[model samples]
Target: MSRLKNLKKLLTVLRVALSLVAACTFSTVSSAALEESISQPPDDYVLVRRVIDARYFTPESVVSRPDAAGTQGSEETWPDIKLRPSLNLKEALQSNIAREITISEQDALSKVVLREYGFGQKNSLQAYAAIEEKIVELNDLGAPENLKAGAVIKIPALPRMALSEPNLLNKYNKIPKGSMYPSLSKVTSFDAFNPVTQAFTEKPVVSGDGRDGSPLVIEHLWLPKDYKDHLGGIELDQSYEEVQAQVISVNMESESLAEDYQSIPFLSAEERMIIKSKLSGQPKLKPVLIVLDDGWPNDEAFYDSRKFVSEALEMIKKRFNYPVALQHPSSQSRVFTDYPKEAFHARSIHKSLATLVELEPSRVWDDQRVRVVYIPLSTAQVYSKAMLEELVVLRLIDDFMLGARGDPVPDKEVKAKRKIARDIVKRLKQDIGVKDLSTDKAIIESALVFADLYAVASGNPYVVNFSWTTRKREHKFTHFDFNQGILVSAAGNSSLNNCKSCRPNLAYSKECECADNAAAEERWFAVRSVSNQDVVAVMNTARDGSLQCRSSIVGSRSVDPLAISFNGYVSDSICGTSFAAPRVAWLFAAKLAYIPPQEFSIYDAPDKGHKLREIVKKSRQGGASGDQYGLDIKKLFEN
Candidate 1:
């Protein structure tokens, strides 16, 4: 019996050794096959080096999928495997936990392991081998053959230094260089400004205007030409201004008749000529206006709605002799279907641009050098519920910190608190079945819009017209400091009572008169709510300068320094505060144009908005006194 047992043990050992050799051979063959498959990577895919070094995993860190079949003669089956916490490899290794995932048809073992471990794709052989061994050991996968479609596997918990590390394969999935869409993976900087002459050598000279004889070269870092070609093109026509005005009037009046609204009337040739005659001898100064709103219609019609944006901009250029560059969404946008109100969006944009350049051309500065840039608000509100919830919670956290700890919380504490908030939001989202709102495409598009806005603002003196608003009161993340320019935001149309003075404690005390006991009235509006000095809010007013009943009062002098503007028929059928905001934007642009380029340094001052407000106030007829300062276009230019 001893001799038989010894022989059987030797036979069992030999069988096991032979199986191990066969497995090694199979793994070698499978690796070669994987190499062959990845040799010709897809067009959208790119190879990336490993970001972090591989670390050792303890035995307890390895976990296996439960057997699908029950033990022999047993009636019980194992429960489905629960997913490990969404921690990176390093974190998982520290916690001694392994994540279980099922393999899909398109997944390669190497890519799967790389992505799962936060190592990114196209990792080096040495880096891949280290992680591969642990993954295979954890799931008892001897060969790549075990990684079949729908096969269950365990991912060894790995740690990544940064949580914001992006998967390279996912990052560059479809965005190629010079594509219509802008790249969001990297921070884009627009440092180079486009010269008015377009030629690098020929600098346009703006003489006179009480300068020191040196030529005043006005240059702006406008949107890139490639970006323009993709989103909207730059329209620069040198046709006689009067002739262009006549063409604009004829086109606008004819097209408006077909739309749902009454006929759109533009500045008549006679009216335009009279304005030109008033500024006949003034030196032409190039003033740029950036309009932020919904996208305009491309040549192709998504629907039968009126297509007046391109025509309106062209007419504005003709009437004012200014070049208009639009940064709206292209028809090729993936989220094109999301924007159902393009017609209304286009009208609002048109109303703003027209209010600034055509309808109320500054009498002091020649309209010849005006430049209008239209930037789209966004392709669509593709923000996920998770992101919105996170923002809401984060805002509350910030407010609490400000009230308790006071302003400027420490960076370390802020990061720690924010991380906890984000984790809470993530867990809640999973429990509530709220899908993440952001996609690769949406992120790229949104990033492009903001990047363009930053680029434009960084350049020459510019006025950004935000004729839109969001219900979210606090925009801690979205708030931008236009140090070189000013932001004119529409005080939303929600008709909520102003609660600018209401404190946090007041809301709980029930003494606040706001519609919802809000801590701040600006809470209902985004940009308007921001307490930045550069931002000026505007509300709607009748033709005679009486505040419109429907418009929301910002209730703060700092917010609504120049409060009102006429928002009527040619604006929107609804006549929103959207039209009112642009008139103020025009006022700023006109003031910028009035100042000599040598004195452009005034915009760099912190009190530039205040100085401009004072300058505008002095120009007001009767020097309008009260918080509700009505914007008078004629008086604005008289000073």
Candidate 2:
């Protein structure tokens, strides 16, 4: 009885307390709240829960704050500066020119010309006026046109480019992991094809490889004056109407184009007159060069340059080994080069490399940095025999030889050829082991880019370049690759490519055609190859991502690239998939200690590769192609 009474009393008291609590809750919900008040608040108030307080981020060592009233102050430093056109003061000074010069709206062109030519005060004003009148009469005879806006304003510099290219030939900055191109430059004559002639004779000599090229000939051909006589004089196994033999020639000296515009355009007679009055000045300023030409050349017993620059850098670090580099997939490049140079410019390749370093590229627009453009649709030939047989072999096996007939390459038929490429890239790079390389460094790099030019242009500390230029695309070639990552490249050799295709049998080339099959092959010896950014080595970075190796260069279609021309030897070397940009980036790492920042400026290191990749990531242009990996040579040493 006592226990029941105690329980009833306790229940009554509990019920009374619950009623009071409910009344307070309802009142609080209906009333305005305060800092200490626990009731419904205004829209501005966001809920804050603190299970574990944090003042800093661990591992990364970044200072952080808890999500509370006091933590809203942290923000990106100077958000406005991220844009390209916004122009931070110093960046503005780096611009080509400040302004444009213009004449009045009602300016009369001939009247001004007459006045400038001393018409009125020339002792014979009537005669000068008569001359002007006669000139006007001639113009009237030609055609009756609007004479109100008569002044033919002379624009000294073209608006097509950003005025003069003397300073910033800012390339398409496509931030590594960011966006696509957003820059320009000067003194860059790197046009890829001749817009006017479109002939092989105008192309530049390639940087790396044997005189003619690899054993497998591509699309070009070389003919000698004695071809008819030589074949006629001898009894050959195979005969043709013209030259019948393919010979390998070697002559090393001279080569390629400048990406930025280095030439000065004529604004008026003033420029010409000034040159005649002044004495010869200093040396000419060159462009920032990059390249990569691959293959088996340094090993050949017969012909080799005075210095095999490709392997020259290895001498500096004989003990340390480096990472093995490989090609990424083409279908996945972020910045589509349509040419081939797009491959190595993989967003991750640069970003990851930049991450290793620590700095990043400045852009025109800060908000939306880069664009990643992924291309997953597979078509025809993507990989070169060298890349597929070499670095990718470990990734793939004999079961993946996909051609017109999807089957593996027969081991017995092409074992030797396959071994050459695989042997070169797959070895554990503990030290410089390759024979063709001149130096002792173990981390040898290769690419579609011309590393020799990069070394020469950027001034690598421990690098000797092996590259050259040429007049005809079908002539002998020169090339090299090396440890300390000296990259190289071969030009796309061909004739006037007037936008056409080959004959019925696919015997005649797009540029050069012949009546007979044998004649066409002989005529187009160093056959012109097609490229689109870094297609040279569209490596399968991870998930089938890629970058380009082929690019258009600085040269315009009206003129062939002034840079070195190159091509594969036989009909087999069809695509100009030179392992370019990556090779230049590789040399950047291998020769870190010896040289200063050359290709791109070296700033404070901040995950060098990451920054490079960030440039693309921020742009988000390459999309799927951004997945490929590459070295960030720009951040070798944090400036």
Report, for every candidate in turn, its global Cα lDDT versus the true structure.
Answer: 0.37, 0.23
lDDT of 1 by residue, 1-639 (tens): 999999999999999999999999999999988754543212121111011112222221232213212221111111121211121233223221233566889887876865554443343444455567656766678975577888766664333212222233332211111100111111022111212312111111211122111111111111222322322211211110000000000000101112464434433465345444443445335456656444333322221111223333334334323233222334455333233434445454454445335434353222444455543323232222223233323332332232122233334334433433332222211111011111111122222233223323333455666565533311122323334565666765554435433322222333334423111444322334335434566655554443443454455433333333344235335355666666567656755656665564545545554565455445443433332255554555555
TM for candidate 2 is: 0.17
lDDT of 2 by residue, 1-639 (tens): 999999999999999999999999977866634412432111111111001101111111122223211212122221121211111111111211111122356545445433332223244344334333433442352322333353332211101111111112222111100110101010012122111221112221211121111111111112223322321221211101112112222111112222441322211254233322221222122212222112211211001111122132232112111111233323234222222222221222222222212211222111111111111001111322323233223211111111111222334213322332233222212111111211101111222122332333334422222221122322122111222222222222222223223221122333224212212232111122111121111110111222111211222233211122111111121122122223233333233332324433453222332233232222212222322132222222222
Worst 10 residues of 1 by lDDT: 241-250
Off by over 4 Å in 2: 1-358, 361-405, 419-639
Predicted structure with the largest lDDT when compared to the true one: 1
Query: Largest TM-score belongs to which candidate?
Result: 1
